[model samples]
Target: MPFTVYEHGAVAGWDVARPLRPGRSAGISLAGFRYRSAGSADLPVIPHPAVTVVVEFGDGSLVMGDASGWQQRGSLVAGLVPGAVRVRGENVTCVEVHVSPVVAHAVLGICPAELDRTVVALDDLWGRDAARLREQLGDAPSWEDRFTLTDALFSHRRGTGPPADPEVVRAWDRIIVSRGSVRVEDLAAEVGWSRRRLWSRFRSQVGLPPKRATTLVRFRHAAHRLTAGDSTARVAAECGYADQSHLHRETLAFTGVTPAALAADPGLAVDDIAWASTAPTETA
Candidate 1:
């Protein structure tokens, strides 16, 4: 895989790599990051629409924290809408996997609802397997090899794990395809489920209720547009918000930052390189 070196602004001195080929499973994406210098790095984590898994190796000093000053170190899993979090580390090297909620349960071996917008140690969910994966990745000779290992592990887990409900998957697909503009009633009708049933099932299976999920998807789309340097007014109008104020409220609720601030976020600035092939409304 080719690596893109970012030596300015937020991700200075970092080598970010993406897989040369696509992963075997749908809704799964991988990005590899290796910080060259031994100096510390601290960057905010913008909320996204996927389950984020960071498998760290070098120095094992990566730390993730939230607004309340709570922190966790080493490899970790952050579920959908993990609000106001930041990652800080020294000499960090990791393979970060973003799994769509539609398939996250199967790949992560736990329902996203269990994660519930919190960051937890990978070992808490994957036990010794997480540590072993870190060791294997650390020993890998190259980023491509590490990406291969990571993809293979997710594919294997997804194949053996229990699949999500077809109805839930359909609803999630609708949300993504419609850019979260689809109504819950319409999704329920399409799936031949009642709104109440779809709500319950979607929440249980996909972690967030349909309404919240819709907002997340929509917010993600608007966020990318903003990061691309689009004006707030244009982004709001194009992305289905009623107006700029609506966009502002949603952005503030999700990220605790105004649209202007989020537009300049270092975390989002690397999206084009790390997640180029993914849709703005899809996984991180």
Candidate 2:
């Protein structure tokens, strides 16, 4: 079967559960064998930050590049950090993972310490030993299995620990639903905790203030629109920004690139790309 992007989670922060595509699904060329296919997309370049890992199976070769000097196509690439991504290729019978910081921590148990904004091969990690990873993707899977696979592939890095408080996660859900339009007090009240208590939980779990996470969610929402080629004004209005100017300023602040620039060339802005989808639970 062809690989498909699956959007998962109720929270506004995008999380995708994807499957390994069949060779025919994505046109892949490996060892002089040409496989013709087109891939899927999860999100667009956004003002919010994220990390992406591209994994290839068997002898499948991967090719990726953008307008900027950054480019790579390998058997495995892991360490691409938060950025705007313009990913397109054929024969990618592999998996693409995009992670929010909070979910990233929960799954990977750590963030990329050096902020690797380039593509590097991980063939050695899977070298001569892909069976473990293949088994992890086998039948009768559960949430724990998904979590475990994610942790195994990316959690060994440095700079983070286990998940934070459950209450903090609950608070994050509420904020995503509100799309950053709700008051902090409202979130605290919903969780039956004081504002300060809620903020503390958020900081501990997500490593950022509640307000910052909210901003990130809003930017993420706007980023989807931007990727779809929507105007900044449209994205801002749809995502509850104060105005187009508000969207522009906020995007520049978070991504260090203009919204226009991001939309025009997603491959360059490493921090604003959407790298995953919310599917796969159903396929399993």
- Tell me the whole-model lDDT of each prediction, alpha carbons only: 0.83, 0.51
Cα lDDT for residue 122, candidate 1: 91
Candidate 1 clash figure, as a count: 0
10 residues in a row with least lDDT, candidate 2: 25-34
Per-residue error for 180 in candidate 1, Å, reads 1.2
**Cα error, candidate 1, residue 123 (Å):** 1.0
Give one digit per residue, the lDDT tens place, for model 2 in 90-180: 5433445554445545444443333344445544434533445534433313433443464455544323456546677677777767877
lDDT of 2 at 40: 36
Return the TM-score for each candidate structure.
0.91, 0.53
Write candidate 1's Cα lDDT for 37-68 as tens digits: 66787777877789999999855479998778
Candidate 1 global Cα RMSD = 4.2
Residue 51, candidate 2: Cα error in Å is: 5.9
Specify the highest-lDDT model's number. 1
